[model samples]
Target: MGRNEFTVAFAGNPNVGKSTVFNNLTGLNQHTGNWSGKTVSNAFGCMSYKNITYTLVDLPGTYSLLSGSKEEAVARDYLCFQSPDMVVAVVDATCIERNLNLVLQILEITSRVIVCVNLLDEAQKKSISVDLKELSRRLGVPVVGSSARSGRGMSELKEMIYNMTVNERKTYVDKIIYSPEIEEEAEKIFEKIRQKCKSDRIARFLSLRLLENDEEFNKSLEKSIGISVEAGVHKKEYKDMIAEEIIKTAERIFLSAVSFKNSEYNKRDRKIDRILTSKSTGIPIMLLLFGVIFWITIVGANYPSQWLSSLFESVNQFVRDTLTNIGTDNMLVSVICDGILKTTFWVISVMLPPMAIFFPLFTILEDFGYLPRIAFNLDKYFKRSGTHGKQALTMCMGFGCNACGVTGCRIIDSPKERLIAIITNALVPCNGRFPSLITLISIFFSASLVFPFNSILSALLLLSVIVLSVFATLGLSKLLSSTVLKSERSSFTLELPPYRAPQIGRVIVHSVKDRIIFVLWRAVAVAVPAGLIIWLLANIYIGDSSLLNYFTSSIDGFARIFGLDGVILAAFILGFPANEIVMPIMIMAYTSNSSLMEYDSLTQLHALFTTNGWTVVTAICVLIFFLFHFPCSTTCITIYKETKSIKWTMLAFILPTILGLTACFLISNISRLIFMLAG
Candidate 1:
């Protein structure tokens, strides 16, 4: 309520550069994606124009106010109830016709609306032209042409926003007159809503929505208006009729205000899509691309990781010497330099380089509009497996972080399929587990090769493990569909956005700040406490053995059944808080060191493993369990938060554990049987 502050809401269809425009206006670094569901919640940023303060709200990207998913519901609810001072409806200049559908719906709810036609540069490149004045005249609303990525038209947009919000002005929108029968029904509903609400704008919009037979919005209407309105057969017919009328109106407006030169602006994108999404080539290409990314991460990160380890070692030694020179207690010195510093640096060294390489490459793909095609290519398998196609997108998100993947399931309109996506998300190893998997593959299988070839082999092997995990996800989804979360397979539409060259500078900034640093911080948060607990276990004695020895010895017999020793199993249990610490914990137990330690190289790590009785069988079991074990604590908590059911969360935990243990036990027993026969 400050004199100069005004709140402006930005609503738009997905991938229309809505967030980009918001960022340009506010000077904030919000990461923009070339896909849907990136803005699952509203983001607010304050921007100044002359003497006026504008607080911009970036709502979730939704096709319409008739909400279908959780994201759309958020957008619709805020705009409907919160009633911002003015609304900016950002549209894609390249596809203004399609984007206009959302604009028309937004205009119906409020009179203070400005249509921001973003991505004008792309439209111009395509030889498509939008007559902004004609469009504004047609919609009876002020329109601003903008290419948000290039910072074009932002000044005009801000100036218009200032004029609209700071100064009182007249505004109007061309009415979307529906069919006679639908209008009559809406009129009756409006009469009821009009009596309780102060504004006729909401009453009119609510009437149309009530006539649309949207039961959820109707429930909200009942509470707001103090009257329940149930839909009948005629109301259902009106729903269909109203949607048809809106489409007709949008087409009429688009034709009047927009023109195309060649009418084939998307030919290049189509040609590329053919190769990338064609059933025969798509899967193979996807595998190859991801394999190459893994290879680069592996080869690129090795030296940096070793250098960081050595550097940290030097720092630790210096710190220890300084403490001793100052006459600090030996135990304190061990705790500071050996226990905490040791584990923390190991995590950072091992995690940072690969993440720094991987996150940016992944961001490049996402920016180039390639990730959705991966979902498009895999949609058929998901449908055949009796799950929603949108699950494929959530599965891709799991590759980054299972917790994020779980949160992303909201995009799936069907609750049954969303839960299926959540429960199986962990099978796909996240950023946290990538370090462990890549390391294990390098040591046990690929390390036999020399130099660069070893990294290539590791990439190939990592690809195979990922392929297996995907299959596990599909199989588990099918099982759950048939039994626990049984439901008819739901259909979903995936929008493949236009390909745009990623802004390299933005990619670097976003990848480093959002993905790499965020994940590394989480790792450090868990590693520090874990290092302390680990040191205590190794140092405290129980009778003739340390607590660590007793802990591992108790699990040795059971672990043997899985071709792993007690030390490995204990490490996994202790690593529950974060997967990044598993290797460090195992190393501490193996050396029987009071503090965590890092091997200088894979060769040294392999030598230590051999000393502790590791074999090919043990490595195989470790890899399997590592891929399929219960998710880390963060992901587990996310699952519970999303599902809000203890039963579902427990199943998510137990299902993966059972599958991993079963696979390990079978491999262990079969190998033992073959060895006995050979003997």
Candidate 2:
């Protein structure tokens, strides 16, 4: 520890403004890693104020430190064992009563603490107010009021932290007192703990944890103290008594420190929820909102995509001319122009615009706090599928990117449920797949409609595909739960946060920085090498035809069985790296163009596909396959990383591919039979 350095940990419940405060204080100086010997993520950052450096650890959000889940265990263990210089408890001002429970638990572990009452603006909006002085007086710690989103009171927060860490301020610690009977029993256990643990705060904490019979925490405490406290009698009864006492004490403290002009702080949110989460309108409204977003993404991307494509084309031509003028080798120019530049251009031009629009809109919903309601609405369905209700939340994440969805499965407490979420996540189409699906729908289905209705029809078609994908997720989840990854549905508490107006600028910055660019970069990394190999296969000759032609001919029979041609099948195989590149590969294969070509409009693309023997049935089969096929390379790698088992990874890959092939074959043959009978 340097003289000017200190460590502080930020702990709080979920949906509080803990993350916002961390980001505001530390800005971009942060990185994340898993806790030692655990899968839970730990975030750390550094900030310098008043010539003193502060290293902040953002602990995972949990309601309590009772060790019921990995998140709670990680948060509790770090605070108890690591012994940071100070602990900052970030609580929601509007719901301060519920948040104070975690704060009281932290007070039992550390004397050095600060209470940050965040979301002051939200509290004010609801006509609820917190007396900061009264809160600090009752808790015997410094209390700061802040609206982190608006950057209010940040300076005071930093100053208070500095004062406490530099030993310039003497603050008292007020520990909560349990009921008479529970306290007497806790004192008995504390005496035994004090023999091995020297710190008074930690000894009491261990005593309580032992009484609670927290298996995970007990193991940790036993290892630390070099003794087993599991011999305590009536442990379960003691835990229940202590828990009831703590809740009563929390209620008493909340009454003293907070006041409300209106008792119903969530009146507005409740009113909105009636319509958004109603049995009748909930699902339909969700579908309509998503449909509108997809409609905007599909219709809005056209002009910008065209502009970008044209710009890239002009740059490609200039590069080609320059290479010729400089006497560069023709082969090298072809590789640079056709293999690398064209492929990269095709991906960015087509993928970027839709993502740019879609991510911001998605962020708006997240910031508005509608996503939890989505999980709330879908929880019963997930429960019926024999998976945890939290899986519904992870499934929604798949819409942005399946890799993220796989990563988001960490929230589920059960190992079995988490694995099920990871495996079935790919059934939901990611943003990468959306471009291909949208383009195909526009070219094949929407273009046949009248002018204003075409875009609406395209959006409806995309929504149907999405609905089908959700059903696939549910069906596969059920099958996996019964057969391979059998588990009972685990329960979890989902907090429906109060809605707030989204900050447009921050939403854009966060979405673009966190999601759009991150996913795009991953796709680009895989697409580059895949592009080179694809170009070589198309350009290299074998017996008076290109190698691609030879391979497509060999696979034509099997491909036809799925209502697809060899060229389309080969394109999908080569497009495993990135779904966004599938249409480009298909175009390159069909036109026999040496480079990836860009069509000016869907009309031109439709004409090309028709010339290549595409019909409505072929398009329908392609859509079904797209919805059900194997996960992309990025998603597969994420699954392996999360599961750490090759067996599960291979199963994840095979399961979806089998479903896709079976569905496409059945649909194709049944349609052909009907046509034959009609003729």
- TM-scores, all candidates, are 0.94, 0.91
Q: Best by lDDT, which number?
A: 1
Best-matching candidate per TM-score: 1
Task: Mark the 10 consecutive residues where model 1 has the least summed lDDT.
Answer: 227-236
lDDT tens digits by residue: candidate 2, 1-679:
4369999999987777687788889995221111111123568889899899999988887778874676777788889888889999989898888888888889889878999999899999999978999899888899999998888988999999998999647778766677676677778888876867658988887777776776666687777656585544445677777777667777887999889999887888998999999999999999999999888888888888889888988998999999989999998888778777777787877777887888788768777777788878998888778887777777767887898789778777888878888998988888778778888898889888886699899989898998888888889988999899887656667777778778879777776666556556855686677668777888898768999888888898999999988988888788888787787777777767433445656787887888888888889888888878889998999999988999999999999889989998998999999999998
Model 2 spans > 4 angstroms off: 29-40, 168-170, 179-199, 219-234, 512-516, 541-554, 592-597
Overall lDDT per candidate, in order of appearance: 0.85, 0.81
lDDT of 1 at 529: 90
Model 1 residue 203 CA deviation (Å) reads: 1.9
For candidate 2, the TM-score is 0.91
TM for candidate 1 is: 0.94
Question: Hey, what RMSD does candidate 2 come out at?
Answer: 3.6
